[model samples]
Target: MMWRKVKKFFSALGPGLVTGASDDDPSGIATYSQAGAKYGLATLWTVIITFPLMAAIQEMCARIGLVTSVGLTTTLKKHYPRPVLYLMILFSVPAIILNIGADIASMGAVANLLFPSVAPIWFSLVFTALLLIVIIFLPYAKFVNVLKYLCLVLLLYIIVPFLTRPDWSEVLHHLFLPRITADREQIGMLVAILGTTISPYLFFWQTNMVAEDVKVIRKQVMVNKRMIIVAGNEADPRAREKRVMGLLLQKMGLDVNLGMLLSNVIMFFIILTAGTALFPKGVRNIETVEQAAQALRPVAGDLSYLLFAAGVIGTGALAIPVLGGCLSYIVSEALGWKGDLDKKFDRAKGFYGVIIVALLLGLLINYLGISPVQALLYTALLYGVTSPVIIAIILHLANNKKIMGEHTNSRWSNFLGGITLILMTLSAVLLVYFQFFNRS
Candidate 1:
């Protein structure tokens, strides 16, 4: 029975798990590594503090998808003015492309470290082409399964912490304590962590992915002659629909909570590994993933260094597609064009077009001579600047009864999401302050 339950849970895992894995992409890895190496485990509190905040916001996005039967942009089109939604699409597409650019470059850099003979540029082109092919040709459901398996790559980070032999007492104290400095650099790092953690790309991705997941579920229900009916409220058709949605939401809660928990666990361990290995020595300045990996050598051994580098490639491979997909979904929805991954390329030309064009543009960013670390930091800062508008819109949608129907966010959901909104708002505020007013 236990085995069957486990199998069922794995089978139910979809967008949430993929999103969680993508959260730890090379950009996040870079930010967290910088945090650990520069500030030690002091930023460890973010791993815990952001879990509920991230999970809550994502859960709201998922519910919006499942309840509304559309992607986030589509829903926004209904409630907000056309120009507002368009501005969102405009801001997000470029930002997501930049994000994908950074991830691809990181992947290539890692490839170079692994295969010293090959040029990183060649690897970058090859990997970019492979991602395009897989996402373009594979059926959506199969692609999702491919990502789920790819997430296993995250296990690499989990093990590296063990090699460091960290002091459990200090680790525990740091985990629970909220230690922060008002120094501009520390504030900037915190904003980057928050931006990378609760990202705008994820807002669109989760909403759309959950919508697709529900469509698949309803199709299965139809095959079973159930008409997607509810168990409890069969008398009223709309109410029965609401009940059925409740069931979907319940399952989604499990998947999302597990995914977010897993994402944060990986985050915590990665920071811990870097902190234990790098901070005690005098090595604090790590600008790139490769640099951070090398910094681990004196304490964690050469094998750990190689594994750390490989992880950059793995997580980047997982993340680039998500960034690309979020762009496609936003543009496809904005254009009122058919766009579902399960649909054939011929059927979803606009959708596939957005993905292809976005990926190609992202590929172009590599040759522009921007270092991967610079790209990563630029991506974080952009997200930090834009995340507040997205979060406020999300909070608005979660509370709106007309859109979510009977599935409006509960008080607890509102509380957590409210916290997320305040946090992101504060980040934006500090970003403006440090960038402009504090230029001294």
Candidate 2:
């Protein structure tokens, strides 16, 4: 019975888990490492704050997909004006490209750092090609399984921190206490943390993947049944809808909470590892994931450095594709091009075309000479600025009962999502001001 239950649980894990794991991609790994190395657990509270907000907003995205059988952009077009939709695409796609570019470059940089003989550029091109081909050709079910294995890389962070032997008492204190600051640099790091943690790519990816999940299941698993009308055909249609929605919501809730919680827990551990290993040694600043790993060697141990290096490569491999897919979903949906990842490349030519274009554009960033970790921070800043707008749209759409029917957000969902919006908005505003006006 227990084995069956466990099998069922893993089977239910889908876009939520992928989204959560991708949240801690190399960009986040770099950000969290900086927080730890520079501040020494001082920023641990961020994970505490972000986990619930991330989960709530993601749930709304998932719910939108489940109820409407469409991605967020499709839902946006349904309810909003064409101009509004185009403007959003204009604002977000560039940000997504910047992010994907940075992620691709960083992934290559980390891979190069691990094996100096293999050039990072080669890694970047190869990774991009592999992701594009796999995502375009592979069946949806198989692709989800591949992503699930990538999630295991995130577990490295959880284990690596123990090698540093951090001060648990101090780590716990910082983890619980909210640290408010007016220091410009600290504020910048805080914004990066928030932005990278609950990012715009994730918002797009989660909604689209949920729709894909429904599509795959209906077309493949439930070959003889139409899931959309499954509830309506029941004896008590109203109750049946509620029951079906409840099951989906419950499963999604479990998947999302587990994924987000894991993401933040990994965040906490990364900070702890950095703080314990690098902060006291005055090796605070790091420009690449390689540097962080190298810095930890003498301070933490050789094993710690290896694990850190391995983690940077693993998570990068996991995340770079997600950044690509997120943009692909948005672009295809906005243009009314066929946009299902589960379809063959020939079948969804425009959709895969956008993905290829995005990845190819991302390659140009590597030749521009920006350090990989620095580029990651810049992307986080972009995410910080762009995500609030997306989140606001998500919240607005999630609350509209006309779009969601009876599946609109619960009061607690609204409350938590509200907190996320306000917090991200404040950080984004401060980041903008600091960059343009307060740069003294």
Candidate 3:
């Protein structure tokens, strides 16, 4: 019975893991690596600080999806004023596509590291096409499983960090003590790391994945609901008890809050590993995933380099689909089209088309001679600026009684979420000020 229960729990896990792993995208890796190499453990506290907040936000997104049976875009359309929804979608859609474009370039960069003979542009195009084919043609279960395994690539960071033989005392001290630098560049990088880690794409993806989880649970509970509806006719107490158990299981499955916490914890560690290993050595400059990975080889040895490279390839591949898919979700949801991965292409033509188009456009962008490193920097800055708005919206949506019903955020959740919002807003402001004002 215990084994069976564990099996059931494992079976239920999906969206949370996917969203968490996706957080380690190439851009995120670059940001975190830069953070570690430059600041060392001084900024390590941010990872710990962000864990709960990231989890809370993601959980709220999942909850919104489970309760409403709608995607984030659909909920925004219904609850928020039209103009607000339109503005949010407008900012969100292109940003996601551009990020996907950056990911394609990043992934191609990884492939080039492995096979230097291949042109990066062609490599990016071929990889984009392959991603499209897999996502469009493969079954959802298979696709998710592949992504899950891809997450193992992140373990490379763990091994590499350990091999670096970081000073444990300093690592601990930095993890606990908050260090502030007046240097504008450092502050900007800090904000960039925060922005990329707790991003908008994860929000949309988490919510939709929750909705999908609900559909699965609903199918499993429909019979129980029917039994309860017909309870009076049978008048069987035992049957009613069984119905209640089914309902309970369904309720557990729909717990979006729990999902959010789980994903956030994972995010915290990924940042933590990077902060401890990369930041303290004065290895500040990083522009590409390859640079980040290559930096590890010197300290962590060839094995570490291999692992870092593998992690980049794995995370980059996993994120490429999501980066495109999330944009597709927003476009389809905004336009009021049937949008779901479970649906066949015929049923959701526009949805799939958007995914394909985003992937192709990303491919083209990579081929246009735009350096992946430059694209990542721009993407990070863009996300940093736009993140506060999305976070504010998420907080409002989560707290809204009309949307969340009885599952509205607890006072603690709201308070924490508020704090995160403020911090993110401040970071965005600092980043812009540094970029445009301080440097001047």
TM-scores for the candidates: 0.95, 0.93, 0.87
Better of 2 and 3 by TM-score: 2
Model 1, which residues run further than 4 Å from truth? 1-8, 226-240
Record all residue pairs in model 1 with backbone atoms less than 3 Å apart, i.e. clashing: none
The number of the candidate with the highest TM-score is: 1
- Give all candidate RMSDs, comma-separated: 2.1, 2.5, 4.0
Question: lDDT by residue for model 3 over 1-440, one digit each (tens)?
Answer: 98787556646566776787788787777777777667666777776677777777877787788778788989888878888777777677767777888888877777787788997777777877788888887766677667666665665666666666667787678778888888877777778867876888888988887787667656655756654563445568687755554453345444443444444444444455556555555566767778876766665577766777777777778888888778888888888888688777777789889999988877777657767666765666676777788888888988888887667788887988898899888987887777677775
Q: List ranges where model 2 is wrong by over 4 Å.
A: 1-8, 220-222, 225-234
lDDT of 1 by residue, 232-329 (tens): 63677767766777677888898888889888988998888889899888689987787888789777898888889888888988888888888888
Candidate 2 TM-score, C-alpha based: 0.93
- Rate residue 390 of model 3 by lDDT: 81
**What is candidate 2's lDDT per residue for 131-194, written digit by digit as tens?**
7777777787787778877788877778877887877888888988878788888988888788
Measure candidate 2: CA RMSD. Answer: 2.5
Query: How large an RMSD does model 3 have?
Result: 4.0
The residue pairs that clash in candidate 3, if any, are 36-278, 36-279, 37-278, 37-279, 40-279, 40-280, 59-260
Residue-level error in angstroms, candidate 2, position 241: 3.8
